[model samples]
Target: MKTFCNQEHQDQAVEAIKSLVAIPSVCNEDANDGTPFGADIQHALEHSLELCKQLGLETYIDPEGYYGYADYGEGEEMVGVIGHVDVVPAGDLRLWNSGPFEPVVKDGKLYGRGSQDDKGPTIAALYALKAVIDSGAVFNRKIRFIFATDEETLWRGMAQYTKKERIPELGFVPDSEFPLVFGEKGLLQLHINGTGSNTLNLSCGDAFNVVPGGAVYEGSRASELKSALDELKFEAKIDGQKVEVSGKSVHASLADQGINAIVRLAMGLLKIGEDHPMLHFLAEAVGLDGYGKNIFNGVLEDDVSGKMTVNAGMLNIDTNSSQLSVDIRIPVKISKDDVVAQITTVAKEYGLTYEEFDYVASSYVSLDAEPSITLLNVYQDLTGDTKNKPITSGGATLARTMPNFVAFGMVFPGESKTEHQANEFMVIKDMAKAMEIYAHAIYRLCCNQK
Candidate 1:
């Protein structure tokens, strides 16, 4: 191979990333539409298809609308570089430090909804393939790039695709932390419904996978309840003349974002101080000043992926009662048992009924596993990033499925965690580095026959 660290190869990677991120590949693909992930997914897949075609790889868009490839190399053993093109919705556009769709560059970072998540990494992987092929790197194994959609809400895209076809012997999903992930925790989602409640009526947020942004409790006077919450930390807004609370730097689906709105509202209403169950729950889980328990609760430690987070996302209420729900993502060390126990304990004491939700699990990739080692070493050897060590994370990604799959690098070391956060971004430098890592991994797995 004629050394792929050339300017032309790097430019191709950056251009591919820019093109893919421009598509709003949010979960517009409703299953009913048969476009399971919507037009955005289509656009993302099309972009990948173009790349695959340009690279002279044989491709096929499964009848299910997902696109895959059989980049034959005269070998039965296949290697895969898996990634999703779809992204979680660019929530609370105003909360964004930048526009969700309008990609930008500032202080050496590219900003957009899909910048740091799958798109950035997926494009990099594609370019890596291109670089290797262009450099005349010959191998006996088949290398495939799976461009998937519908990963934001459910992994139907990958699930359906994988079921219909045989996957490569080993692969990586460049959609998580770097230095490689060796372990990932299992996830479960629960949907609790109250028989009924009038005064208890409340619901907030958009996607189930994300922490809900905020919720509303309505009796005869939503206006008055809205008024009471006005002075709180959340900025109260009304849609269709209905009251809603919008806060800065928050999201609706991720649990942590919901906590932002919940704690602020609880602070002014409960007067029970920070130790109050509702306040403490939101604060401790979401990593905020949080009901004044920052010291005792260890609120500042959202490591690997940033912070373990929870959001009081949705609520439903009528004249009789209210149904409150939240989204949560904490570290593996944090017990789900404790989560259930805490909510149950608090609800019983506070005279409230609580239910749990599971949209995605808090996931981490093992740093020492075969796949992780291959991924990390490829990155380190190619980028000379020896100082950085393997890491952990809380943000859920496509790896939640595939029992063995781990999150590789879409986001570089020292970059911000922007997967579900506002103004998500990736750096040009980072994308190039990811390409180098991916190319080396593919060569090691498929070419060298690991």
Candidate 2:
């Protein structure tokens, strides 16, 4: 409960975050010997590891660019703190007040693409370890800080790292909100395929994990589609043969908060032709609803986690073939197999082929567990806020890859949730407080109490 973090530590953490945000480490398909996730991500990884080395910690970077880690202390047992350096692509840079890669401080907030999603928290964690080491605390266990590059994509970095490196017995990922995250819903990405017609050419969305904000369509029946869109009060533009629709973008895990432009455009197209396979499939299977009720039976919910969410995040259609990329978050109690089976059946009924990939199972840690209890106590003691209890999240984190690992705090309670959104920013004071909390948590778990 003692305060180990000072203004100096806070300043160091802020500078580190700024340095990292200056690098646009968005994942790319370009692969090479040392840059599997492209050169930018590789640079970010090396920069972070070098910072660790500068802090007098032993550092290691995987040769294949899967992951990297920094270690402090010497002991038989180890504790881990995992975070990702790669960020999602900044969509439509015009939406941001400042450059997405350029870190800007205004009104005591750090504004950038990865500021809140990861870079800020990652830097805070490194400084937390530094504080513990500076305190001259004796440790019975080693503390390993892991940096991953592909968390925004398929998480191939963490997957490969686990196969080649050591897995900590107990750890926490500083990727989610505090008090603590005891449970996370399973993550599933599905691709639905169907034959395309000569009616429309369409494309929308950037990633499967984010709702589509705008879609462009070029085809016939422009007047009919325009009428339908106007009736719904949705944003749209019709010019000759091309039509564009705009909707709000949000994390696919929180699909309910977003109005998917892909679905809205499909519905408008449906009013033009009911028999259009791609449009009908989207309207009937995906629909405007976020619950996948009409498509995959009913909404899946549980007492432990919550209701399931489905988002048609990406869509493409042309004269040859069409594909719909979907992201679904299943509650802890639901089985992925069951959901897949139902979706496959529905897709087949619509003459669309369905295939699911990138499956991450739900993770849960009992409230009675020592690690959970310790983390919660540290958060409560640091902030003097004990009313907020541990909760479940729809977003999956690296915590699901290893046993006894759960997502701790980087995001604070009542803060704006802006991960994977335009103009993302982190409160400066919250970042400092998170550093303090992480410092105490790391010290308590790594130091020898006996």
Candidate 3:
């Protein structure tokens, strides 16, 4: 067997990642009037298909508007390389030293939203396939290269896409940890409502999936609250023009970006004791004590993903209704029934109500399986560090939607998470290495071997 490893292959991989990262495909919000989640998903799919065509890989977007894929051959067994182009809204550009979609490369790191999340990895996999095709190797199985747009919200894109397409006999997604992901915890989203304290006129957050960058509340004492909030310079705007408070809205995911006019006017005066029904409700969603951390430490500890994560993503209050929106991610092993029971019980105790309007279960790629082990072997051949085992995470990818899919590396070690945060990026060099691995794995899988 002749092995193909060279510099020309590496350059193509880098260019592929760069092209995909250039698109601002934030998937946080659905298209207006049920236009399919994340308005930009279609654009991303177009870009993906464009690359596929340029690389001479046969491609199609399927009937579902969520995803598309490029193929390499015809065979009984299909190997799908799944990735998502839909990205979380870059929270707080101010936190990011670089533009989210500008695709900045510095000191061996590329920064932007979806760079580390999945786009970068997706592109890397594309180039990996390119390298295999360029290497003059023939395979018996077809390579189905798919990139999804709805992985972050739920696996709907891949789920619906696969409903019409053939499932791959064995494949791995480059959207999660490397060296094999043996187990993945289920993902859950809960919305806690009715905590909007009438006493405080305004409150809001960044998004449903991230920790709120900031929050604010104002009381009937408008003048007093205004003064205090102005002193603190909180985000969001609150105006008292007609004997009442008017709150202006800001992009929820980017709270740290800056304080909006309404929130700035409402914060500072109100304290945590203001009887926030939403605050209490959110705390209880992920098994946190609903009475705030003072009562139960306000944190869920998990061995796999580390700490149970919670983000106070949204807060709304009006004359007729009040609600608080929170984002919580826990280890996948927790039972859905238990989580629902625990949250429902807590809401009852707090005299508040809650509901889970959104959720995505966690996904696991068993390392023991051939799909995982072969991919891991490909990486080990390149780096030789075997300690980094595939681990479960609160973060999810396109793999979660498919039965056999799992996220592999686009990220290595010593890198901070820039997914929902700011200044997200991936190094050209590191991304090249990832493609090299993908090429090896895909080649092995597609070749006339078993």
Best by lDDT: 2
Candidate 1 lDDT over 146-197, as tens digits, reads 7777766667777787788876666777877677765443343433333443
Query: Candidate 2: deviation at residue 295, Å?
Result: 1.8
What TM-score against the true fold does each predicted structure earn? 0.77, 0.96, 0.81
- Per residue, candidate 3 scores C-alpha lDDT tens digits across 1-450 of 345546776666566667777777766453574446645667777888888899898888755466788888867878888877887776556567878777777898877777777877887777777777887788889888877777666667766776777788777778766665655555556665563344555545555655444444444555555445455543334556212222322222222332233222223333323445544444333222221233234544466544444444566776556765654455655566766676666667767676886776666666677677777777788779688776776554556666766667767755444566556667777777677777788888887475
Each prediction's Cα lDDT score? 0.61, 0.87, 0.62
Cα RMSD for candidates in order: 5.2, 1.8, 5.5
Which regions of candidate 2 fall more than 4 Å away from where they truly are?
31-34, 219-224, 238-242
Off by over 4 Å in 1: 29-32, 66-72, 96-99, 105-108, 195-203, 208-259, 266-309, 318-325, 330-369
What lDDT does model 2 reach? 0.87
**Model 2 Cα lDDT, one tens digit per residue, 28-56:** 87655457889899999999999999999
Each model's backbone clash number: 46, 0, 31
Instruction: Please tell me which model should have the higher lDDT, number 2 or number 3.
Output: 2
